[model samples]
Target: MDYGPWSLVVDAGLIGGLLLVGTLIRRWVGPAQRLMLPASVIAGFLGLLLGPRALGILPFADQLGTYASVLIAVVFACLGLGEDPHARTFGRSTAAFSAYSFAMYALQVGVGMVLAYALFVPVFGTPDGFGLLLFAGWAGGFGSAAAIGSVLGDAGWAGASSLAFTSATVGMLAGIVGGIAIANWGARRGHTDRLGRFEELPATLRTGLVPPGDREPTGIATTSASSIEPLGLQVCLVAVITVAGYGASEGIGLLFPSFSAPVFVLAFLAGLLVKGLARRTPAWQYCDQRTLKSISGVSTDVLIVCGIASITPSLVADYWVPLTLLFVTALALNLAMFRWIAPALMHGAWFEKSLFTWGWATGAVATSVALLRMVDPDLDSHTLEEFGLAYLPVAPLETASVAVTPLIVLTGLGWTIAVGWTAAGLVALVLPFVLGWTRTRRRPPDDRVEAAP
Candidate 1:
């Protein structure tokens, strides 16, 4: 009924409880240990089962679905503050990784269109964009889901957010479980030179706790607390960027009612603009990357919880078959690309790099990095170096896909996602080989990291 800011408080309280319980489960449970399940994932599922719509236990508000959009805007707003918008890294390894990464972004979502038309739309009378949940969730994670959900939700599909959330949760589960199994398989088959065993994985990974001596400051006090709190300064900056972006988006919509831009896209652009201008001012000294990241991380966690808990059991049951088929398709695509094709695309540290890609392809960058740490405890493969630099080129592609995906569905251009991204991926792959930037075939494993040329 009629609610106010207190509803926000109540929702926050319930989610907080769930997060605590989820954390306890991860700390004590065996399966979460094996799967490396994040607390947000567990909490969201718990909320789904116990929420008012399901068991009438946790009385959630109607505004829960909307939280994902808002939180993702915050996440996007903070990203530009810390990012180097300039195109910097483009070595051969970077090109190959970029191609592989682009393929994940493209085909994962592209194939969804094929499935929607060929199977989901016909058999289930589902909308053409129904299968887009695979890409929105699998390739982009919760933040992408929030962006996609906000778009589709505004377009009159009420259940879009829940379906997308479900897809994201499933993708995360599959990515972690499969990544672990794949890492072990590669180690056994002589694909990995690092020889990192699962048992040898750091305790912090499983428990999300660093030993006392290992703990580090989350962010620096760039500004004196007497002037302004460091974390508060970061939050204020994020909020300003978010508001500016959303205001511009609204202005654009009012000027051209036929056109609309995703708030996340605009917020990201706004953050970049704010960052650029700030670079020429004294305020640049106050903006800390770590502080910005902390804000982004908090937004992501809350967004995941809200997004996951927003799932309607009725909606899930209604589309169980198609959702299942869609998830299976995503898993199969990742398996083929990360396993069979990865070696052919890289000269060194193929497994580590590919596994890292697999993590982000199915989930997010955090998942990928964690998977990388598990396999390369010492970071000897230098896969992060390759990815950190290699990702610069394809970063725009990733952003564009997030911005355009809902439009692809809303505008009846589903075939473009299917046909266009596939062609682009093929071109990206072959062009590297054609330019002699990367080899066209897999090199024999030799336990040596190649210098990117």
Candidate 2:
């Protein structure tokens, strides 16, 4: 029973099995297919049901919750590893997209806090920081929720991690279901020009598996036959950065016991530093973008399953009313923004652009990309292109907020922080109009390219 490191193997095997089962279920089960749920989401729900928290069928370790935090760091460390940041050119679309993205973050936090203070505190007796779960779950996804929840848990907010995870789960479900509904509604209402039948999508996409023909080679044979493999080298490089990040975080924690920075924040900075160094060396050519993406993807899938399994259902049940209120309020606000605000901000392919934003605001980047693919299969809408450019400016501010918000709340400045963030949100909301970034010209018919086969 003292499995130690071997326990990791067992847990990983269980996760793999669950992924396989989820894929099969999605492939054969009519309802799951109809809803277009990802295999990872299904696997996560299964983990929640079978793990110790729910049915107790699986012998998962209590430390599974911590896995998300660490895996998230690994995920962040791989970001922009082989990409060029300076290549992107920002224009009106990028400016508008960046503003909208930041505005969403500010509005979610502001509205969430206000509701938590005025209603949840009086009605449910929730903690002062309860409102943060909205932004942590919806905007930051499971990773941010885990990191921020860990910080809150240390600050005497009992069951914060479980509540945040629960919120994340709800957000993911809402993003997928709501996104699909919206896409369908758009198609029905003649708002979207290209809407494909869900049944027609490839099985690999539906099941989240790479088919044989589509599977790229794992690594390039950069090394001699007797030397270490290229894949091993990449893995080692990532491990080195991750370890350095962990050490830095520990050092910071030791130096500032009051406000320990999240590991993912440090890891991201380390990644950028490593990438910068690599760019100046011969090794830059050896760094494969595809392999890095695969690593990040696997980390994310594992993180999602572990995060969902780690949720403490009883904690969620206790605050169901307030949690429900938070979820409804956030969902409504996001929908309204996409319906009205997005059109005014983004010019070309406005509906497609807004749809992508809706997906990301509710879930994560992957969810948004998936929804985008559904509406614009060929990616001709240029939402992804504009988002890529906009993210360069938006990422630093977003990450800073994610890392610092918990610390501010922990210092008992929740109300002041909420007001400041709300004001910032209002500014971001109005900046597009003031700067004349709002759409003035109508979109031409050719711009809304039909979805390609």
Candidate 3:
């Protein structure tokens, strides 16, 4: 058929069509950004079903893989840019937040690993294969899962794809459910604190990613650098930071077997370091906040689009049960954390701080922001900024907690799945309030305000 060029065009058309559909779905769903799941999974499934992998009408499967790289980079950069160093400082509240976040992931991972180990040896009774390794390592990182799956698939494990698909679906759903619960809890409890007097909300993430004429210069201002070229030098700065961070993290990661922290976590810490270093450089002072804003916006959009494009529908259909369990557990945890923990830790606040915390846990910052925005559409950008920044600094700790536990595969699927259920049950019924209350008491309140200026 000699449809090489035609394949490329068709793939692009398909992706674009999916994007439009996703956008519409997002708006309809209300959060607008949360639709990344449906859009990406549906589109990816369509691609797989219709691509060379299945229908052979579009041979763009390889192309989709290439785009995944860009998606990862963009996501990492945004994550880095999103961190707020001021909020991340080792204050009592932040320290407590960090500790609690780590504990949560640790518990989940620990339970997951134990379950995996039991299932692998007793039911499956095979330890020498790549599937076992992939399953265990994947508990630490989805990337690891994908890598392991492909490796095992090559080694002739039939369910390698299913495992990878299941993990991702579970993780994403966990994120969303967890985020929503936190937001609602916060809404009910009302953890409201005004922005500190010393702080000014940031207008943008960096200088290079800003689109020209998209925003009025006077309308945005957080620092002196806010006026530089839109999407200019800042983009270079972000790219440099991202690459350097990725390299450094990867190097450190290799030193430890299960310590595969997300590259985005490293990039975020690097961005904070760069921002701090710039404080010393006169040139750094000239860096524009608009660049940050532009970079953040663009990267977010690209990542979302690419993520949707990368989804594989078959995975969702096959592994819906476990994925559903993970999501439900996350949602319950979010609520329990707020109802029991937040007030004790962040005392003297009238509003439910747990809501905000859940948003970060489940959906990361965007979902949190969406939660807040839904409550207050006029919610100032600074408030969102403050919360966004607060979330960044916790990335490393969260990654570590999630990665520490590894679950290998097993033949006894019933007992293995049972472990996951039991863990989820405990998390749902107990840990949230226990950890939340402990953190509340151990950490003293700082005079710092929680809300934005």
RMSD of each candidate relative to the true structure:
2.6, 3.6, 9.7
lDDT of 1 by residue, 301-344 (tens): 88998988888889989989999899988998999887556776
Prediction 1 TM-score vs. true: 0.92
For each candidate, what is the lDDT? 0.82, 0.80, 0.46
Alpha carbon lDDT of residue 342, candidate 2? 78
Across 1-453, the per-residue lDDT of candidate 2 in tens digits comes to 675998988898988998888888888887886666677778889999999888899888777887887888888788736475675666777788888888888888888888877888888888888989998899878777777787777677768888888888889889988999988877776667788677556655565567788876755656665787777777887888888888998999899887667677688789889898889999888888777877887888888888788888888888888998899999999988987787678767777888898887886887788788788877888888788877775666667667777777777788866788788888988998999877766444324423221
In model 2, pairs of residues that clash are none
For model 3, residues 297-384, the per-residue Cα lDDT tens digits are 5444433333333445575555455444444544455456555555454432313344445544443444455445444444643445
Q: What value does the lDDT take at residue 277 in candidate 3? A: 77
Best by TM-score: 1
Worst 10 residues of 3 by lDDT: 198-207
After superposing candidate 1 on the true structure, give the runs of residues whose Cα lies further than 4 Å from its correct spot.
85-89, 258-260, 438-453
Against the true structure, candidate 2 has what lDDT?
0.80
Whole-model lDDT, model 1: 0.82
Q: Which stretches of candidate 3 lie over 4 Å from their true place?
A: 1-17, 28-59, 77-84, 87-99, 118-232, 236-293, 313-332, 349-351, 373-393, 399-453
